[model samples]
Target: MKIERIEEYDERFEKDIIDQHGAYVINDETYAFQVLDRDTCRVTFSNRNDLNEAIEEYRFFGGHISCFVDQNGKILKEYDKVSFFDMKLEDIYVSQFYVSEEKIKRLLPYVKEFLIPVAKIDGKMVSLDGHTRMKIAQLKGISHVNCYYEEAGDYAKDFMEEAQQRGIFHVYDMPLLSKEEYEEKWHRFCDDFFEQRKAL
Candidate 1:
């Protein structure tokens, strides 16, 4: 899908989000929760009430909401929450972006004998997203990796470009796929591996 690029500092979308307060209706019933700034976009919220219950969750989890963009670059009616779940050891794939020579040296030994819960993303998974836990898993040989199934759409490219422009190294690119393609591949992978699954 093609998407028009909006220049940095464009206030239109930001204004729209803010005008709607903390929640913007994407479609008839689907809504995207808005946080005031970038820092608050990374937190995981188990429920909508979680946003009001704590400042940290509001700041981190409510920050950036995901929405589909049409070819015209207008935000579409459907959107998704960014989330992940623990997967068994064998189903996870090590990201090419995060795989460095030193990381390899450190990670391989643990991979040999245990299941480690690393974050897997089919789209641009930010460095700040789960960098700490991944490092700890690498060093400690922890079991169960958190896998983020890439949500297919053009939004990830924009997010990645913005991230790069801001000098965020932890956010890295993944192969783009449409939403249907992503779901198909994920189901195929799950069936092939016979692994237990949960959605975050």
Candidate 2:
């Protein structure tokens, strides 16, 4: 099935989401929306066709993204979050040293966008965020995740350089630490860097 993203919205569709409550009468039976930062208001499919034994309940909340199908189409109950990797493991660098087992377990069950970018200082790609997800991906034996280049801040170069100095060149290089160990080691190091920056 092809997913066509609606780039433009009509008046009623805009009013239904923006005006707090525009009633479901304005929808086209397959329209669904999840407003960001507005939990109370939800615009869903207007066509209530054959609910008897076909479908019982629809989730009131959506994931990070919103999906709406076309006429004769239906909402997808779940989505496959793809992690398309291009660069090899050797091409990527890790910014952090330790990963918390607790945090990894907590996040592994959820859908996440695994993004990486090139470091401005050294011209090498490093993970600014989603370090845990990267590690998890590595543990799962998947090579080459997604890359969103040039999105790193200036401090990212420093973090990557520090990780490089510590021999952490890839996600697999970083070791798993207990929550306490992670806080004491990784968090302290990050905190110290920010504090030094503040002093400067």
Top lDDT hit: 2
Q: For candidate 2, lDDT tens digit of each residue in 71-124?
A: 334544333332334676556787777788866765575434444444435666
- Each prediction's TM-score against the native? 0.24, 0.55
Report the CA-based lDDT of candidate 2 relative to the real structure: 0.55
Candidate 1: where is the Cα deviation over 4 Å?
1-79, 97-133, 151-200
Residue-wise lDDT of candidate 1 within 1-200, one digit each (tens)?
11122212233344333332333222122123343222122222233343333322222322234443333444433334545555543343332222223323332432322212232245433322333234445446565555544432333344344445544433122332444564565345545434332331
lDDT of each: 0.35, 0.55
Worst 10 residues of 2 by lDDT: 52-61
Record all residue pairs in model 1 with backbone atoms less than 3 Å apart, i.e. clashing: 35-62, 40-59, 40-60, 43-60, 115-143, 117-144, 117-145, 118-145, 127-170, 127-171
Supply every candidate's count of residue pairs whose N, Cα or C atoms clash at under 3 angstroms: 10, 2
TM-score of 1: 0.24
